[model samples]
Target: MALAVEERRETVAAGAARDRFRWWGPVGVAVFAGVLRLWDLPYPNAFVFDETYYPKDAWSLLQQGYEAVWPDNANELILGVPQVIPLSQEGAFVAHPPLGKWAIAVGERFWGLHPFGWRIVVAVLGALSVLILARIGRRLFRSTLLGCVAALLLSVDGLQFVMSRVGLLDGVSAFFVLAAFGCLLVDRDRTRELLRAARAEGGRAGDELRLGGRPWRVAAGVLLGAACAVKWNGLQVLAVFTVLTLLWDRAGRRAAGAWRPWRSMLRRDLWPAALSMVGSALVVYVLSWSGWFASDGGYGRHWADGRAGLSPERTPLVDVPLPQVSMSWVPAPLRSLWHYHAQMYDFNTGLSSPHTYQSNPWSWLVQGRPVSMYWEQVPDGQRGCASADGCASQILALGTPFLWWTACFALAYVLYRWFFRRDWRSGAILAGVAGIYLPWFQYQHRTTFSFYMVLLVPFLCLAVTQMLGAMLGPAGCPPRRRRWGAAGAGLIVLAIVGCFAYFHPLYTAEVIPMSEWRDRMWFTSWI
Candidate 1:
């Protein structure tokens, strides 16, 4: 009796310690990520890769409520001492929606239109993403240790690190998508808790209980809409996640012992779910275009006024004739917006122009063709280059090789666990991967770069952390087995850290000897 009591006390103490670590551990990792991203953030003073387009557009949106034309030497002039921002009054036809530029504009508005200004907001979001992933992992796996591991892995990923430092839409949009996933996870837990509470109150197992408006689900919809406002790809994520949440609802009802759970799900949950997720998302998505709707100079803002464009009588891709005569009651602004969407769709699907850094989506997982965002060759004596030979500085948007390759195996293991063992956590992580990744396969003919894989990194980290938790074995496992598993998982993490350190220079555009840089390029394709 005495020994049992002591064991109980010890177990309770351990649980309390873990509970305390949960808050500090994830926050510590997030802080570390922030320092790495924000340190010397303005190193490459000039525009890197696509920075020229997005940052200028952000400035235009800040000034004119729409993307405006810039002078030919805008990049050079913007960086000049006097900072000549010669923006034209004419609006430019931007492909992406405006929210991401607005996100960048927030930082630029306060810090001035410089490198640090545009990149600051993205860097902060990137760090926050790490914290969010950590929290998500904790909730999914029920282990603070595993949550910290997931966050640490994301903090070191080269692609995430680089994207955070650059003024691009992908990183900001990724934050919203990940946040929505987190919200859905919370909604899942809340739903199960409510079902359990109803049972505790002596409610019948098959009772069609009405859970009041799911605020978490609604929040998720708003975040998804924000993601779509940043990029069209977010719509795919929104669709997949909507289906996922509904399936979760069905499962929840079934688990609550409801007979004919599918029927109950449709009758009781369908409308509410649709209104909460899809309806709210649609509203937010339309509201995100308020700037475009308000601006007369916005591209296609007046397309209904007899502009020289293809008639909206038919859809662009399918050539399906629309009943425009009957639908003429729709507002002219909405009509112009619909027409603009068609033009945007055509541009997005048809963009196959050759690019030096373009890579097929199939090769993305293997880091086959990392995009060279910025590169500069330098003589040995210039810019802290101490080598006798030439020096090289470059920002390569590549995933940490060891971490990503390990994740490939982890992904396979996660698939097995989800398919064969019916693990819900694995399925959730895979949902994110599928939603963010699978859609790109259809666009393989278009020019795509490996850097876009940044959105998929958090999910990959979760998969890896889950696999590591498995390696660590269950708490009831034999001592020897647990020891060996811990050793193996620890070694893998150490290897990932070493690999990240090895390639840190390429990620940050640090000047290094040409020979050293060449050595870091394990594959010629990476160059």
Candidate 2:
């Protein structure tokens, strides 16, 4: 009797310990990633790549409440040429939305127009994304260790690391998307738990059940709206995940023994789900444009006035009427806003201007044609270089080759699990990856780059971590086999870390001998 009592106490203690293992693991990894990203962040000391556009635009937004056109020498002034670039009253025609620039503006407002000021917010977002991913992985896989592994992989991914250190919109958009997806995962489990409880309470099959106030799903919609506010590409994720959540609802109802679960879900859940996700997202998206709406000097603010006296034209191809609207009751600014969006839409779809570093979406998964965001040829004596040969300093936006390459296999495995095993988790991951990636295929003829793939990296890391969990074997596997499998997975993760270290110089613009830089390039395309 005493042995039985002791054993019960030990089991209870173990369960309590497991329950207590929260936050610290994910928090620790995030801090580590933050330190790496923040270390010497202001180096190279100039706007790199599209930094020429975004940081400047952010500063304009901060000072003017909207983007303002700058003088021809604005770059020189911002880079400390002893002159202030005065903002012109004319509005600047920017391609992307204002939310991302607003995020960068927060950092610029605090730190001035220096490199650190513009890049800091992105680094912070990137670090928080690590924490969110860790928690999401724990929920999905039901293992804290595997969750940390997922976070670790993402923390070390080269593309994410580089993007974190730059003032860019994609990182911000990616963070919001990841956050929304995590919230949806929480909603999924919460709904299922409610359904299970209902079943236990003697609820009849096919009975309409109302699980009230799905706060997580509502939150997901708001985050997705924020994602869309950053870039239109987020619309794809919003569409895919909205459908995914509805399917999850149907599956949950079925699992709870509902007869005709699909019909029950339609009757009991469809309107609420749509209103929570789509309606909330639409509201947030409109709110995100408040800065533009408040500023009369924003680009295309007078577009409606310009079109007020013009007649609609017939299209040459189809004889369809060209879109024209005259809403006398609506405020002029709102009509102008609608016209502005239409013009922006046309600009986005027609962007085929070639860029030096453009890569097909097909090559993004393989790390082909990584963009060199910053480069400086430092002579032997300059920039702390002691080597006899001249040095190459660069910030290369490339993924850790080992991690990305291995993730391809992991993605294939996820597809197998999604199709054959009907694993919802695998399907969720694939949906994210597909939503971010497949749209790029439609724009193959346009100028796109592999750096855009940063949005897909979090999902890839999740898929890889899922595969690692499988490699650890089931609970029923022999202890020796499980041990060996765990060791192999650990070694693979370590190898990926090692690969990241080897390429660290290129990712961070560290001064290294030309030969060493060439050795790290590994491919002519990378050079």
Candidate 3:
């Protein structure tokens, strides 16, 4: 009997090992994302959407610190061909910070500033996001295979795939957001193990167990900070993640038999975590703008007015004081830039344009209204040439319909586990959604688009696959049920892949007839 029990235990252990990373892994996810992003990359050959702004800014950033306008007809020149360095320093008004565009500039600088070269930065970042999501999911689900599956879904999603192929700021922001979330996951695991060990070793309240001495957590902080530096929306992740980390620390304290885990962390871990994550991020952010600070022609470069070289020195310029912001120490250009940011902030929150593609937070997960990035009327299928059949072709700004739909139901499961069972996994998923989604509610009146959800996609994919894996059951589940669940979920995945393929043309802006484009526009909002 004893021998039989031991053999059975060994069999279960082997099964668990099989599920860990038997097949799916980060490399597989990278390949999947790369295939989706790199195939037919130079499709329309023209810059799409706001590409008119970003790719040029990126190029300029590589050459100069600030955004400078290209020649009047430069758009046509920059479209399909690599060109010489543009020397004109005419100012261009831009909304977000420079880091994301600078990253894109790096690719354009190296690859000669064409569509693919400009977009290469976003594609690489998107690929990295897949790897990070896979690793994060592995840690979260405690199963590496499931983690890979999570990344696979994001790798193929229309929104994610399209964004990765374009020179957009959103995808870069998404990369940092996902990376930060992964870092927080590492912090959680490290802290948990430390908490467990301290209890095991009979450590006292004053005894510092050095729980989760995690460099990864610091990495997360830096990433989140970078996210913020990319766009202010990242501040939501910073605020939400900071609060969540503190709460986790509190829970860790209570679990570790500390009289005051929160207090202990306050005295020891909190400041260090802040400095590590926040400090590292601040340095990176400032460094991202090193070009901006170093150059005299930058938008806000005149702030210091020569008080301190490179540093925007604070100056008191209120002799004829206009407003309360008359700081003596802050420099002129810096102060002007500060005011510019204030105006930008108010503008961001106050705008209420009824954009055709603008979607509310509620519909994002289900993809109710996908933005249409590009469209054209193709005559009766000259490309495919079906005699009488008309095709509606397009680059629809939509996700894989079935994949996003699955996330809807999966998100519901996240809520169920978070509110009912207090599962930390559920909480973690919810925190991501909260960081991305909840803030949008206040901005509902603003001109927000569904594409903004791109940064939040990795976490949503993880949660969806996590719920799917749970439905598949563990190795201990009844054999018949486990087999049936795995089969069903596998079929669902197969269907999602099919949907991705069907939508691939639109995502990549491949030329199809107008009728086919109409067909892809499942809703009028998509048009």
Candidate 4:
């Protein structure tokens, strides 16, 4: 009996130590993520790719309430000399919503109009995303090592890195979406705590349903709203979160022994959930347009007043509700702005451009096609090359192969956990990918590219780490199984990091000899 007790105590102690492995893992992963993101952040010297759009648009937003037009060939002007280019008063019918543009503007204000300055915001946000995933993983897996693994995977994802180092609206959208996901996570813990408290308060939760006022739910709504303000696809994110949170609420009530879980949710969950998540979201979204609302020059600011381009059929009387009704004084620009949006929406939904980099939605997970952000000929015998033998060089925008490949398996694992284990962590991953990727299928004919998946990249990586943690089995599997699991996961991670380093030059637009560059192209599609 004494021997058995001592053996049991030893097992408990071992389990305790295993749990502690995650204590400092997040910090180590953080340092790794930050270092890789910050290195050569402003490489390529000039705006590498879409940095041309968001950074300039951000500057324009700062100068004006809404997005305004630039002179023809504005990128060249912005790229050269003084480098602080502002937009003209004429409104540009930007296809995307304004929130992301505002985020870029905020970055520009802090970092100045330089490439490094604009990129600083991207890097910071991307790093914060890593931290968010780490925290989420820690909470979900109850293992710090697992969380760190998630962060490490995200940090080394070539696509995420490149996206982070360039100014783009997608990063801003991703930031809000991740924030919303984090809020839901917080809500989960808070709800569980409430249930525990109810159980302890002599309220037998085994047969009685308990409900709690969830603050994190409100927080999630606010973040989702911010996402919508940033991009239209954010609407999809908001929808997914709404369902995911409500379902969580329902599950919470059921676990607490609510006699009618569905009824309890409908009665106690529906209204607050709607107002808190949906209503709060609406408020946040409108607030993102505050600059446009305040500025008289904003495209649609005076639409109600009937300005230029307002068709009689589309423009309603502006003074119907007002005491001082006078259509004679309405602004033309506002009317034009209203019409502009309708047209922009039409254009976006109807976009059918032949983009070389565009890839099908089915191909995104495997990275079947990499967008060529930039390419130039290093003529034979020229510019640091013995490439007198026809050298081919290009920046083929692609994710690190190891990172993407692991994500594939990770996502599959998440599917298993979501359905079989009914894990909330797995559900969150579903919400993110569904909102970001699945919707793209409907817009298959539209001009879309693989780079947009950068928003889902972190969550995809987290899915991978979550599986690794589960496979490792709570630090209590047979010694052989544990050893193999650790080794396998470690090797996979190391391989991903190695691949990231190998592709760093192409990702960062490093000028390489044609032959050397072509050597990295494992796929014809990559060219």
TM-scores of all candidate predictions against the true structure = 0.95, 0.95, 0.88, 0.87
lDDT per model vs. reference: 0.90, 0.89, 0.78, 0.76
lDDT of 4 by residue, 1-527 (tens): 99999999999999888666655567667777788778877665576667767777778788877778778778777667765465688766677778877777766787677777777777878888888888778887776767878888888888888777777777778888887888888887887778667767665453354455678888889888988887778888888888887788778777776677777778777787889899999899768777777777766555556333345443232313323333444465444545556656667778888977788888998889988776666666765655566554455568888888888988888899889988877887888889888999998788888988888887888888877776676666799888888887788889989999898878766667666786788888877
Residue-wise C-alpha lDDT for candidate 2, range 303-404, written one tens digit per residue: 656455223443223335777555566766776776567667767877899888998988999998999999999998887887787999999999999999
Better of 1 and 2 by lDDT: 1
RMSD in angstroms between candidate 4 and the native structure over all alpha carbons: 5.4
**Candidate 1: stretches off by over 4 Å:** 1-19, 205-207, 306-313, 320-326
Q: How good is model 3 by TM-score? A: 0.88
Q: Could you arrange the candidates by lDDT from highest to lowest?
A: 1, 2, 3, 4
Q: Which regions of candidate 2 fall more than 4 Å away from where they truly are?
A: 1-16, 81-83, 205-207, 306-325
**Model 1, 209-235: lDDT tens per residue?**
777789999999999999999998899
lDDT at position 10, candidate 2:
100
TM-score order of candidates, best first? 1, 2, 3, 4
Q: Give candidate 2's total backbone clashes.
A: 0
Task: Return whichever of 2 and 4 wins on lDDT.
Answer: 2
Query: How far out, in Å, is residue 414 in model 2?
Result: 0.4
How much is 1 displaced in model 4, in angstroms? 28
